[model samples]
Target: METVLHTDKLTKTFGRLCAVNRLDLEVNRGQVFGMLGPNGSGKTTTLGMLMGVTNPTSGSFTWFGERATHLTRKKIGAVLEHPIFYPYLSGQKNLELNALIKGADPANIEKVLETVELSDRKQDKYKTYSLGMKQRLAIASALVGDPVILILDEPTNGLDPMGIAEIREIIKRIAADGKTIILASHLLDEVQKVCTHFAILRKGSLVHTGPVEEVGKGEEVVEVIAYHDDLPHILHEFRGSLSVKSENGKFLVRLRDDFHSVDLNKFLFEKGIVASHIVTQKKSLEKQFLEILQETTSHRQPT
Candidate 1:
């Protein structure tokens, strides 16, 4: 895949405070890439740097394997914070004005509006649109330019569940069309659902980066239950168990990355123990995110 964006040792400082630290990243073509972090974690600042709204204090970055300039920026459609449109104007008119300003083809208006499912409301005044409709219109403006990449900051923030879901589906559709997307959001679930790759930031630093699937492919935790008398012996005999604790009449066993629940059951069966119940708990992205934060926090503390 072609590299759409690349950064090397990117750093931003506000006097004594570092808003973004020595960050390095590469976003490939056709990737739905996510930048995830809590508030004040520099997610927005990083996007700002990429968009050229904020200058980097140090280091450098490139878009499409070349230096980012006004012309290069035109190839990227972006929405930061919120979409802007005239309240008195219709949705189609709003897009037309945007298309004119962006030098985008006027013909793109109809297609982009339909892409966001706002074609029916194209003649309706922007003021009459719902918050979700307003957001989708904002995305429509971005699409008018037919950019190679999309950069969004908190695309679903401050919206109800239905609104969030609507925006998410639109984004998924855009990614399906092979447009590279780089989105910065604090919503872990949104990233897990939409992004193929993600980078977790903590206090202006890059803490973790990988494919989304890898986040859930960590060590397995098996919940097992055997006869009351056999439980203690099974726990004591399990060599692959990392930690074992009793919870709700079952043994919650944390196992090494290579271990599985079936392995535990096999081990017990060989020893003449029959487990009444056993289940493998699939790790969620939220859990993995918290664990990464905790690990980074611990590593940053003084010895």
Candidate 2:
């Protein structure tokens, strides 16, 4: 795959804080990459640097296989944490300015507005639009120039469920057209649904990066909900092959490194206890994220 964006040893420091540590990233042409981390994990700062708004303390990045320059930046589009627009201008008017500034065809104004499903409200004053609507307009501006790469930082931050779904669909359609996209969000479910690959960061450093599904793959996990008083003794049946995660009335079981869910379930069933419920689940991006974050809790430096 062709790399549309690449970074090497990227770092950013402010006074005594390291907002972003030595990080390397790669986004292939047409791939939708996700960045998963909590607030202050440098996701926003990283995007700011990638968009040329902030200077990196020590590192290098390239767009379109060449060092990022004002000229090459034309191929990128972005919607940072909050969208910016002229409150007094109409939605269409704001987009018109963005279109012209990017040197895009004036007719692209309506095309992008429609893509973001904001065409019906194009004439409304920016200040009159709801927060979610304003975000849609911001995305419209980014899409006007038809950039090959789109970078969004918490694009769905303030949206309700329906609004979130709307934006997610729009992004998927963009990627379907073969444009590369990079989404930075705290919503693990959203990332699981939209991205092909993801990287998880903790304390300004990356802890995991791989195909989305693979990142969530680890030892098998099962949730057992049984109304039994002697659950602890029942758990002993799984001792040699199952690592007991919790013994609460409802239990979470981690299959021994070498055991599979099927084998474990069969064992539980043979032990004469009614397994009220058994759900096989992957390790989950959230689980992996928290686990890694715990590892770095003591090492976390103010950033």
Candidate 3:
């Protein structure tokens, strides 16, 4: 599979501080590649360089297999941070302005408006539009040229629940149509739902980069919630790696990889401990995200 975007030892510095360290990234065609990190982790800076807004202090990158040349910018559409629109112009007019700048077809205005579900409010002035609507319009601007790659930074910020849901669905549909996506977000749940691959950055440095499922790595952790006080004691004896979490008057024991649900049930029954709940947490993107976050946090000293 051909990579739509590739970076090799890309670095950026702002005077005394390094905003983006020597980072290597590869985003293949039709894959939703997620960049996950805390604030000021160089997510924005990396995107800026990739989108040609920021200059790299050193290193190299390629888009669509060619070097990061001026012509490659035409094949990509991007929305970075909060979108700024002309408050006085109608949504249609704003998209028209961008479409014209991109040298895209005027006929695409209606198509993209419909794609972002903004056809009904196309005539509404930008100031009258909701935050979600503005985002939709921003995304519509990206879709107008029908570019192969879409790069978005924190696309769901300030959106109400419904608006977030709408954007999530739209992104999935775009991916289904085979457009490559480079998404940078702090919204772990959103990333988990939409991303096929992920690269986690910490303090401008890349920590973990692989398939989304790789982060979901580890043993199948089964959680046994018990009401008895002795359950924790009994659990400690049989576990290789256990996480004992207490909540709602019960102890939640995360069983080790070698333990089976049936084995735990049998042990609990024989030991005379009442099992309140036996829930298994499936290997999920959320679980993986949190593990990575915790690991990163541990390495940093409290100031």
**Candidate 3 lDDT tens digits, 1-303:** 997788999999999999999999999998999999888999999999998889999999999888876567767888999877899999999988988877889899999999999999999899999889999998998888888899889999999999999999999999999999999998878888899999889878898888876654555555677667566678766545366666765555666667666777777787887677876667777667678778768777564
Clashes of 1: 0
Q: What residue pairs clash in candidate 3, if any at all?
A: none
lDDT of 2 by residue, 6-96 (tens): 8999999999999999988888887889999989899999999988899999999988889888767667788888999999999989988
If both were scored by TM-score, which would come out higher, candidate 1 or candidate 2? Answer: 1
What is the C-alpha local distance difference test score of each model?
Answer: 0.90, 0.84, 0.84
Worst 10 contiguous positions by lDDT, candidate 2: 239-248
Q: Which segments of model 2 are wrong by more than 4 Å?
A: 224-240, 244-251, 265-276, 298-303
- Candidate with the larger TM-score of 1 and 3: 1
Provide the lDDT at 250 for model 2: 61
- Model 1, 1-303: lDDT tens digits are 799999999999999999999999999999999999999999888888998999999999999999998888778898887877899999999999988877899999999998889999999999999888888998999889999999888888888999999899999999999999998899999999999999999989999999998876868888888875767666767888989888988889999878888889899898888888899987878999999999999888957
- For candidate 3, the TM-score is 0.85
Query: Which segments of candidate 3 are over 4 A away from where they belong?
Result: 225-247, 258-276, 282-303
Alpha-carbon RMSD of each model: 2.5, 3.3, 3.3
Best by TM-score: 1
Give per-model TM-scores. 0.88, 0.85, 0.85
